[model samples]
Target: MKKARILMVVLFLLGICALLKCTTNTQPPAADGDEKTSRERGEFPDFGAMIPVAQFLKQYPGHKIFKLSQDYPKQLPGEDKIPAFFKMPFDDKSKWMDWLLAARDYCFEGMIDADFVAQDNKKRDWYHMPWLHYGPLASEGFSGLAKEAPISPYQLAPEQKHPGQVYALGFYNDFAGHTLYKMWNTSTDPDPFVTQGPKGGFPEGTVIFKFLYTELDSLDVPYLKNPYTRLAYITPTFKDSTNRIIKTMNLIQMDIMVKDKRADKYGTGWIFGNFCYNGNLNKGKTMKDRVANLVPVGIQFGNDPGYKTNWINPYPVVKTMINDTLKETFINASADLPPQHLGWGGRLDGPVDLNTASCMSCHATGEFPQIAALVPAQAFIGDTLANGSMKYLTQTDAPAWKKYYYNFKCGTAYDPKKATSTDFSLQVSLALEYYWQWKNTLMGGYYSHQYAGIQHMAIRGGIPFKQVKMIKKRGKKQKVDSLTQTQDGF
Candidate 1:
């Protein structure tokens, strides 16, 4: 009888654990070091994670889940900053390659220094932006990558047949973490620094790097093979997919951006650059050597507002078109760099990015509430004829389309009335979108529900038929429709 009682208790406990994700989470999130008193004083409410991990674990027990790196440094301790490797302007012949190489090395070295489990350790300390694991469009599975864009059948190469999804994951250095800690210090509540805070935005030398992986393999792109691959347990394309599966994704692009205004005479104030993994350079004997195979795509600091080409390079790019006249863009034509369908007449975009948008063109619109669509309406809005010669955006010179190409200074919100600017951090804007949506789901709030982008979340691919008014500086107005999810990482 006693044995039966013991067995029943053991079975009940097992059932409870089996029904949920077994975790050592405690209330109020920050589980150590006088955090309760700090919370009482409104210091750091480290509200751990919002994914409702238990439910996700129950749903997808066989797959892996991400750990929230929310043990954010509440107080930035030192005055040291990442040294400016560029030293001179990015265009200076002496330091140009150094600038691009530094960005590449920064990304690669950081990835190397990260603990094997990624940002899950505080001692080895690289961090992920919290609250990105929310809706169907939020973040998917073990990779914790969000769907950024779709690749058409022949987008990357001629042999390509299957349409695929682009999944991206970005990491912030400790300096950027300082800014994140400040903005989320209030924990469950919106910090004043979020959209309109005096101390909002990253400090001068924050370096963020992202790795973009594609569901397409060597068969699709030909250049992707061997070590440049990853297995993603994500819910494929549109989150509307019922079952999630392990997709073999390949490393296609790595984007690195820095917050510095020194060389940005155009005043947009961020240095953006990316590299394309050239698998043809597969000469290494080890994994690191094979994976280090990258070709510098380009560096972009500002939108050449003066130069308007109104040109879009269609895919299956055979020859690289390097625009020699743009004042703010630079493309390396080395034999090492593969043929790229550059952004908006060769302004600095990577593989997996919409060929119609530049690095800055897509990132400059990072703000809450997403008053402006991430990309111009012409990129997808009105259909184009299949004649192969017509301009996709025939009205590319219109004020609305031109707005995306204009240089907006750092931290200037795209729409001041509805949201605050993240300078050029698209990850922050996307995180806010996911955070608010999850917040509203937990318990709806007046501000959370209204600003959670309820209408924009309903949108999936490109712009919908309906229109929303995009208000610009000088009270200018233009019709805007979201490309997808209110905002997404570029």
Candidate 2:
């Protein structure tokens, strides 16, 4: 009887050990000669690769990509359902690409009302429409004119030190539409900045796409003749009163920011992708066909220390062209085509001077401008000249640059939860600034009439006039200043 009990006890212990092993063996089996499983290797399988191109075409047949010139019908047929589609598995790159193409088609089509597009060019303008307009800096509240020349202080082209040539920006509605409404509804909530939550605060399925253009022609600066240099100084020139010389503005870059819980490991549950115009087109094609010309530079999913930096260059052809260049090609913008001078690690950045700014690094700085006060002054201002005529701000070896880079990394001092988190949304940061400006206006008891005129027009569609009036009243006493500070390195 004693022997039997001992054997039974041993058997029970073995059973417990087996159960523990089963629970612990979560990782997939490693392949031959491989030390780690697929998950351990930091390579989440590309479920997107399994999807065929034909499948994508079948789903989004119209291929009616968004064009800046054309005024698309507001609230397109399938706009509301986009958020649902955006919820599809984030692990697959192919699926994400297809979703992006489709989302671009649907969201862009529906964001603007078609009737608005048909109205009088002067009275019913896309810019005047509330759903789509420039940011606060270019808005009237700052006394900014719609067609005013781009200012150097706000320009991102550090090398050229020239402002945007033909700057036009607009936001799209998605799952986070309600959030946009709530934040902008100043009459109800005057202090929206303090109300915003931490980094990765945006609800899932939120998608914000920003369209930035640079003029290809250099009629303004006749001395800047080189195509590369011309792109660097993207200053738009104008004609007479009767007819403005609409210079060809190339769709230089498009940036997409998405809120995905799958990216939670990165501190901010967000993914960023940037596209560049490759200058290639089908025979007899034009800039209106932005879909074809705009090629994906790459996508950044995370910036965490443990989360491997996975950059997906969807187009192999473009990658080949860029990779073939010498190492110096990346450090020097003039060596390659302006568009080809992508960010560090081949991430897509346009002709705007952002050689040192990665999508994650730039966007990670998405916090209230007030947070800037807490940050060291050296963090904002980069290093001085080393050899070139332009300041050597791009040098990665400098101590200041290193600190700047480290601070922008995921889960760093700059991105801490309490006072500095903007959830990786530049829009959120901008909104906070706007809120601050509004509050200050109230404190001073006066505001810019010109800025109010522009603000009234932009928010007219989304915000109530009563609320707008309240906001304007607050700004009545304060003088509106140019929005000199920029987030996302733009």
Candidate 3:
């Protein structure tokens, strides 16, 4: 009897170990230099069933060709190209603009050495984050344009803002790319925090640039004329159809975000910089002219801790409006940049972004199993006031309203009970969301997605989502919504 008890105890421990391994995480056996070596050796694990995207390049050969750079680097840039601006102190307000400009140029040089027009620069390498090519705004074409945010006709500089949508392509540098490879280099685990634990997040020196192009032209927004253009296959709209179409859109904004430890001293450990395209300033047809038209909109290092004012620069801005009170945000007063429609209380926001939320605030909610919505529920649906501004449905003094303004540390969970933070990278959070959506579709789920509350977060940032239909064992057909199941008030 004693011998039998001992054997049973050993078997019980083994079962627990195996169960923990399967439930807690999925580990990939990759070591030093493995990211590059494995790809070169073509030793890739199947990423499961591949979803198809439109192939307009084969149909129309006249447009400017685009190539999706996928060679993410495990190594960081050397001394010649290091981000020197980070070494400079942030207190020097005189040189803040210069530091931001250097950072912007660093991103541009990192992508294309021959300037914006160079598509074949061998030395310069940039990559697109994988797993974004799924669902409604699925990335299509070499440019990988994903249908993004919807712009209100009331939000523009020249008072000619038109209701239209923008498509964006996000490019990651070597350092940022490595984080992606580490997070998604395997099919066994796609969660950002799975391979790299919840504490592990994007390392310093990571930089990501998003190129935003809009369908609106000079007539719709008067400031947009002779804009830099690209032809990509994209699904026109979710409201209309998911069918792909070949279309030309003009560059309207360039948003750059960099990971730096120094920023942790004041706010989040990242700095966001925005640039707007003014075709009037850059009219030459060449790529150089189009790129030169991009003017610095601003740079943000913090969310101005303990500051929450119900102030906003009304849309249809006829002249520049810079709030003198914001200490963490710096907007260029250059006459060249068209009158800015800055975000909540004049914080950093891009042309394609909504005027209601700052760049940092919207991104603060990025976490796995995204329990928190990007904006407060009040900001989602509101009334259009007389000033062409959207009035918050709820009072700005609500507790949730001030939550986004708090200084959040890197890789720290926004809601500690439900999810792990993505180190303020909404792209990473969205990527994981899409991957789960695809996985759930392949092998059904036990939840009702049609009633899911995650729709609010999935609507604008990601590709369009459609209901998934499946037949159960009892022959009962149930329609489930995409994105996520009801996760609120849990």
Q: Every model's Cα RMSD, please?
A: 9.3, 22.5, 10.6
- The best candidate by TM-score is 3
Model 2 poorest ten-residue lDDT run: 453-462
The local lDDT score (0 to 100) that residue 446 gets in candidate 3 is 33
**Cα lDDT of model 1 by residue, 346-452, tens digit:** 78888777677788977887776665667765665333335221234454765667888988887887666766787777767666766676666777664653554
Instruction: Give the clashing pairs for model 1.
Output: none
lDDT of 3 at 277: 90
Per-residue CA lDDT of candidate 2, range 1-490, in tens? 9999999999999999998898779765645444332223332111111123575468546632222222222222344444654656544644555545554554345333341121223322232112122333332111111231232222222234333444434453434544443344232432334324543244565666765555633343221232211111111342221222223344455667776666665455666665554443331233233334445554566432232232222211122224322211122122222234344344434444233345565556555443432112122223323321122222234343343333243222243433444555554555455554555677875444223211211110012223323433444322222111211222
Would you list the clashing residue pairs of candidate 3?
Answer: 136-464, 137-463, 137-464, 450-481
The local distance difference test score of each candidate is 0.65, 0.38, 0.65
**C-alpha-based local distance difference test score of model 1:** 0.65
Which portions of model 3 show Cα errors greater than 4 Å? 1-59, 62-67, 75-81, 110-119, 158-161, 194-198, 283-285, 380-383, 386-388, 391-394, 446-490
Write down the TM-score for model 1: 0.78
Q: Rank the candidates by lDDT, best first.
A: 3, 1, 2
Model 3 per-residue lDDT tens digits across residues 356-468: 57788777778776666665533432344665456443345545667767767778767765677777887787777787777788778733532333433433432211111
Tell me the RMSD of model 1 versus the true structure: 9.3
Per-prediction TM-score? 0.78, 0.49, 0.78
Off by over 4 Å in 2: 1-103, 106-136, 140-166, 186-195, 198-200, 218-248, 282-287, 304-339, 345-348, 373-420, 445-490
